[model samples]
Target: MDKIKVIITDLDGTLLNKEHQISDYSKKIFKELYDRNYLIIVATGRHHLDAMPLVAGFDFPIYLVTSNGARIHNPNKELLFSFDIESDAIKSVLDLEIDPEFTTVLFKEDVWQTNKTNEKLNKFQKELNYRPEVVNFKNETDLKAIKMFFTHESHGKLIELRDKILVNHDHLFSHAFSLPYCLEFMDKSVDKSVAISKILEIENVRFDNAVSFGDGYNDEKMLTATAHGYIMGNAPESLKKKLPQLQIIDTNEFDGVAKFLAASFLDADVLKN
Candidate 1:
């Protein structure tokens, strides 16, 4: 009900449609809001190298919270803030013994690394693209892991692995399913809401006055941090069931976020028949 001071959204399932690109309408809406002096920030479970290019066309100041808030970069691409797993914790996760069905992915320093090439990866494009660095994890050491990941098809199986890993290591790291096929591990303190609040504080804005949108378990804190939070219709059933109180927007494929923004701030009845 308070005048919205900032617009923050998650990438993949919230802003980007099924084709993994921001719709023209979405871009236009954000541009209009930008012209009105609203700060637009994108918070994603993606690495900066993987997330930054998608919003490069914004042509305005936009902050990026990457690796599920393990790191943040300003519009100028400067490292605004960062949090990494301690060396010991990184070692423990690296030594994790588990099913080979899951592929490993991680971000270290300025690079995105993987044990092998997996075609299912959304960012794996054949054109001039940001490719993952393929290196056998066995040969890598002393890695200051910003975030580590495992991708597979079975959400239930991933939960099993997640719980098993957390049995002893939960204190060292936090885990979340960015996508049904992807489970991510970051430093225990890493959170998108925390990172967003830091940005808001620097911008001298109120947390309760922020407007946020997201569609995953990783986004729970982010959605709860603001008085206005929306969940995408395409979110996992479990996520919806977990937070049924959050308003449900249309599917991303239909530009749900854009429509909501237009209706809310622009005084447009996009969702009205």
Candidate 2:
């Protein structure tokens, strides 16, 4: 235990339960830590606008690492830092001759836009509680996109597309899968760990004094970057295999994050029920 000073976590499948919301139990633990002066940060692949609403009820100042580490926002949604994908890169992606089966969404500072809509897109929108504006990219100019997301029903197909993109523009972009069906792209230097490192530097905290929890491939770098990283037991076995050194804890559905924090920092067993 290096005296944890900061807590970094993913939103979707780590801190959030099956309903895509933080449990009351987790909320209480988070508030307790916030009151004690521990920095609480949410590092996610989600856009800041979408991510902020989920944690809106928390009264304390929480930081956000959004757009898969491309942007960092303060509690008030002010842009503290950002890295945008070049217009050329966005153009290259848009110019690609891809299958109509996959739907692509482009994320700007204020809104996400997509020309095509499908069942998968609708389902994703429902999860976020926000809908993207339908727009044709050809008419859009000076597009400073923070991220690009591609979704399909087949994981194998998504991997193939990811490989194709890498082969063509590996130097211009970095890629990760937030979900099996979702392929996300950002600047070459972006990753959750990058954001975490920046936050540590800003707070004057040692790397060893940070703890992170996550359950997706996108979280791999963040987990490895910290001394105390825990993967939820509900995570896919493949992700678990990749980080065998980190501890395994109960699933998000079981309030694994809350239980671990309570036991480790609060010195009390919240799971004694």
Candidate 3:
């Protein structure tokens, strides 16, 4: 066989439609791409459980890099690689002055915690498909943390909280917003690029042969690191500015990722361009 070509993509606002559902066009394109022996890896800031359903019905050899690279797994649920976050580091982060009602979801063994109200968090847990244990901090036992998430509403307020945390945790951690109302935390070295490089190494594909797409600040690193990157139109201005040279494709609302792949590899008949 020749070299393996790979395309890594982010989920929301990059692969999924406005309704958070994968479109038929995308599904067909993915089928074609998988049939052609191209590797499709989903690199997202979502937890594994959340990402699993993103490609639920697709029968293809797909890989996943989740939690901003804190964990990597194959489509078959085989653990390829992972990085653990120190419990002490997590405790220090939780010590910040941020609101406790927002709660924190840790990926270490799939642990979740909150001291404030449970109404909002219970709804969140249902969306994520996990019934997190409710603890009062005094009864909590396991502290081993892999990833941390904070759910909030205001982007400006989240950024402010992020900045305050950064002051004390600078260079000690990495952060990303999986959603406008979410803040994802990982170790400093954990990011899509690091995970992509590792995947490339494992698959023996050169970095130059990889193509990636994303639409958020967490995606900026992978988009910048890859030889060719397609930024979704909905990407934040700060993220777009990070790669001033790359081309910006249509918004995820238009199936930007599937459209790009069809144009680049699939036969011309598959795309209207």
Error of 2 at 235 (Å): 1.9
Write the residue-wise lDDT of candidate 2 on 1-273 in tens digits.
648888988987788888777888888889988988888989999888777777775667898998899989877678888999888788887788777678888888777888786665554333454557788778888767889989888989999999988888999888888877789999999998988788788888966888999988899988888878999888878889988999999998988998898888885554453
Q: What is the Cα-based lDDT of residue 238 in candidate 1?
A: 90
- Model 3, stretches more than 4 Å misplaced? 1-4, 101-103, 114-128, 137-139
Per-residue alpha-carbon lDDT of candidate 1 for residues 113-161, written as tens digits (9 for 90 to 100): 7877787784533233455788876777666778988888888888888
List, residue by residue over 1-273, the lDDT tens digit for candidate 3.
133288889987899887777888898988888988888888987677767766775667688998889889976789888887887777777666457646556665564555554465454322565446656654555566668777766778778778888988987898887666778788898998898888888878876777889988788888877778888999887777867899999999998889988988888888863
Worst 10 residues of 2 by lDDT: 120-129
RMSD of 3: 3.1
What is residue 96's positional error in candidate 1, in angstroms?
2.8
Question: What ranges in model 1 sit over 4 Å off?
Answer: 122-129, 269-273
Best by TM-score: 1
TM per candidate comes to 0.93, 0.92, 0.88
Q: Candidate 2: TM-score?
A: 0.92
Error of 3 at 124 (Å): 8.1
**Distance from true location, Cα of 157 in model 3, Å:** 1.4
Question: For residue 62, what is the lDDT in candidate 3?
Answer: 86
Candidate 2 differs from the real structure by a C-alpha RMSD in angstroms, to one decimal, of 2.1
Model 3 scores a TM of: 0.88
